[model samples]
Target: MSNPYFQFKQFTVWHDQCAMKVGTDGVLLGAWASVERARRILDIGTGTGLVALMLAQRSLPDAKIVALEIDEAAAGQARENVARSPWQERIEVVQADFKKYRSSDKFDVIVSNPPYFVDSLECPDRQRAAARHNDSLTYEELLEGVNRLLAADGLFTVVIPTDVVDRVKAIASMNKLYAIRQLNVITKPGGIPKRTLIAFSFSNRECVIEELLTELARHQYSEEYIALTREYYLNM
Candidate 1:
């Protein structure tokens, strides 16, 4: 099969120029985001337009989805991917950094699989490095931007490494965004938790946390994982 395309049950993602391909992180964020009744949605750092397309597929038919990508090549590929989707008319990909892109209207839902590897080693390619590093879009910048662009009741969802959850929570608190729901994901029964999928809102009520396991063993998927993503994953 084609290395550049990842075919889902409802949609297919074509990711040739993006530094990151269709991965578990993107899928987790897409499947985990709260799309119920959301009329407008934004996908920050939309590499390959995967999350945006997933949101489009999950949301109402009239929903408007916007995807923002910083890398030129990735943005071009994302545009192509979005245009070929059935929700093409409802989705638009913008070639602009999330920090520099200005939007007057606030979205009902905002999602991101942001680059949270702070102080990490840099890669050789400048674009890839920028996409992977926190230098181009810091956590502070992301939270501030979300604060500015998200509606009062809008939900912001993201996926990050488990180690970064505290830092992200602190940043979100500074911006007055509270973690309303969280899902901790592990690879297997006894493995270390690698990722955290979080949902934030402007409310300050007590937070709800949930633990989740993605796989039962190496290369073996769990029933919960399959159930959550069965609509998208073709094999499921």
Candidate 2:
């Protein structure tokens, strides 16, 4: 079993009450996401407020960050976690289904490590099943929500299974969100990509495609990964 919480350099993410525990995917999205131009930020499906906290730690002190979650219990945990962090005043946790979530204000940057599995066996735990599967929040639904909340020049970013990269890119296109940057994540130098980190914007801008290797070998983290996450991970 995983631990009840994950300790980082600046904060702790308590996950005992959340369906999805802290993982590398969340860490990657949190560290890799660009908040340079973000004044207002939003995190969708923020299980334990990890990404929300990470962004706030790296962003300007005045940046407004919101963590949106559909699960009531998870949302409560997120709120508690954020309150314990240094960025409590900067990050807000909201319990609302992204599909029905409405905000009169638009966000400058939106990041998510959303449910990506479209075809997968359900976990015995219903809450985890909900957190892991895409049924509750389909790609189309996520894209629509992003399109609705994202400002014209704002960026919408996500990390998803590589198997569905093409399909997701197409859906983003349909939603009028163009792919602006992409990073294929692999386990090793020559390994096949397992996940794709993508960033989208409203304009038809030139897309920058790149590759990221997370590990040099089994149990050995790569330099690039260390550098990217050095500010957050305790041992990095």
lDDT of 2 by residue, 1-236 (tens): 77798999999999999889999899999998889968999999999999999999888779999899989899999999998999888998999889988999999999999986789888899999999999999999999999999998899999999999899999999999999899999988788999989999999989999988999988689999999999998988
Q: Which residue pairs does candidate 1 place in steric collision?
A: none
Which stretches of model 1 miss by more than 4 angstroms? none
lDDT of 2 at 124: 92
lDDT of 1 at 31: 89
Residues 64-180, candidate 1: write the lDDT tens digits. Answer: 999998889999999898888898899999989788888879999999999867877788988778778888888899999999999999999999989999999999999999999
